[model samples]
Target: MNHDSYPDSYIRGILNTVKTIAMVGASEKENRPSYFAFKYLLERGYTMIPVNPLRAGEQILGRHIYARLSDVPVPIDMVDIFRSSRHALPIVQEALTLNPRPQVIWMQLSIRNDEAAALAEAGGMKVVMNRCPKIEYGRLSSEIAWMGVNTRTISARKAAASGGIQRLSLNRASVPGGATEAAAAAERMERERGSAG
Candidate 1:
C-alpha cells in the first residue's frame, strides 16, 4: 500500500481483525516511545508480546519477552516492527516463517521498507509501513475527538467507550462478536492452521 496515505478501511480492517500483536524492538525502558506504545496497546486490550533478543527471558508489562518472532508460543496476529527501515525486510521475512503467519506487518512511524512490504503482501500478509498502531487506534476510534476532552455528557458511557475510554473490545481493534477473546483467538489460529496444513 502507499505509505503516504492508504484507505481508512485498510487500517480499520487490520485493527479490527488482529487481537494479538508481537512487538519487535520493544523497549523495557519506561521513557521510550515503544514503551508507551506497548502500554497503550495493552490498555486497549491487546495481548502484546515483546520481542527483543537483549530482553529475552525478561518481562515487559507483565508479558514475557521473546528473543525472536519464532520464539513466541502463542499465535501473533500482527508483527509490529519497531526497528529501523533497513531492518524491516529481515523481520518480515522471519515473521512469514511462523506456523500461523501474522496477518499484518506494521512498521513504526518513520520506518518503511517497500521490499519488505511487497514480500509480506506477496505472502498474503497486510503491510502498514511508516505507521504506528497506537496512532491509528486514536484516529480510527476517534479517541482524539472524544476519549479525553470534557464531553460534559452524562449518558455518554457507550460514546466514551467507543472513543476508547474503556479497555478492550468495541474499538478499532475489535469486531462485534460473541464468545470470549480466548475462544476467538483459538478459533482464528485453528482456521489459519488448517489452511496452512
Candidate 2:
C-alpha cells in the first residue's frame, strides 16, 4: 500500500460539496475512533449514516445503523470506511452498487487497499486511502488555532506582538489527551479564517 496517497483537487472538490456520508464499520463504542469521527461529522451538520453489521437495526448518534452500505435508505455522498484493507474491496463493490453511486470512498488511517481504490476510481468515484476524514477536515479546514504553538489561543494581534514563530510543534504525541479535539478545533478555526479573510 502507498502511504503517500493523496486525493486530487477533483476529489477534494467532491468532499467539500458532499453533505451526506455513510460510515462503514462505524461502531457503537463511545471510545472508538469511528464513533467519535461519526459524531464529529454529525455535529458539523453533515448527515451521517452508520453501517455496522453488529449494530444493524440499532441507533447510533441518533441515526439508524444499517448492516451494510446497500441497506442505507438515503443517497450517500461519500463512504467513510473504517474497516481493514483486506475487507475494503467488498465494501467498495457494495458502494458501487448504489443507485447514484457515491462520490468518494475514504479509507481510514492505516487502511489502504490499492485494488479497491483503483476500482472505485475507475468507476468514477474519488478514492482516498490511509487517510482519516477527521484529520483532513482539520487540516484542510484550518480548525486548529495554534498548531505548533504551545498556547491554546492566539489572536492575530498577539501573533504579531510575539514576533510569530511562524510555526509551533505541539508534539501532540506528548500531550496527554484532547489531541484530536485540539487538532480538529484548530483546523476548523483556520478554515473559517481563510474564508473570512
Candidate 3:
C-alpha cells in the first residue's frame, strides 16, 4: 500500500468525527499497549467497547468485552485493531458487516493488511495503518502535555521568547516537538510481539 494513500487531512477528519471505538483484541493486561490505548481513549470521553473472544463476558475499564465486533450492541464510530496484520482482514470483514458500519478501521502500529485497508476504504470507511490511537490523540489533539510531552511548554516558551510568534513546524517531529522516539519504541514492541506470535 502507498504510504501517501493515508493523507493527514483524511486521518484528522476521521479522528475529529469519531466518538466511539470498538477495540478489537483489547487485553486485560494493564501493561499492554492496547490496554493503555483503550484506557487513554476512554479517559478522553470516547466510548470503548472491548472485543476479545477469550475475554468475552469480562469487563475491562468497566466495559464488557465481546467475542467479536458484531456483538457490540451500540453503534461504533471506529474499529481500533490490536491484532497482527495477518489477522486484520478478517476483523475488517466482520466490522464491515455491521448494520451502521464503522466509519474508520484503524490498524495499530506494525499492523497493516493492504487487502483489509482497501476493503475498508472501498466501503467508504476511512483506513489508518501503522498508527495508534493513543499516539495520534496526543499528537493531534493538543493533549501532549498529558502524555508527559513538553510540547505546550516548549512551544509557549518559544513563542514568548520570540515576541509572541510561534515558530513550530508542521513536521511531526517538530510539531509535538518530539514523540517519534516513544512512538518508535511502541512500534518496536509491537513488531517483537508480532514476530514472537
The candidate maximizing lDDT is 1
Stretches of candidate 3 off by over 4 Å are 1-6, 145-197
Top candidate (TM-score): 1
Candidate 1 residue lDDT tens string, 1-197: 66545566688789888999999999999999999999988988789999999999999988999999999999999999988878888999999899898988998876767788899999999888766798777655655435563211122234334333343233433332233466446445543443343
- Each model's RMSD to truth, in Å? 12.0, 11.9, 6.7
Q: Quick one: ranking by lDDT, best first?
A: 1, 3, 2
Candidates in order have lDDT scores of: 0.77, 0.70, 0.75
| Model 1 CA lDDT for position 65 | 96
lDDT of 2 at 158: 22
TM-score of each: 0.76, 0.71, 0.74
Tens digits of per-residue lDDT, candidate 2, 9-112, equal 33346556788999999998999999989987776568999999999999897899999998888999999998877898999999999998998898877676
Write one digit per residue (lDDT tens) for candidate 3, span 1-197.
35323444555567768988999999999999999999977876688999999999999988999999988999999999999888999999998899899998998877767788899989988888778878766655445555566432124332212112322222232233444576567666766665454
Ranking by TM-score: 1, 3, 2
lDDT of 1: 0.77
For lDDT, candidate 1 versus 2, the one ahead is: 1
Which residue pairs clash within candidate 1?
none
Q: Which ten residues in a row have the lowest lDDT in candidate 1?
A: 150-159
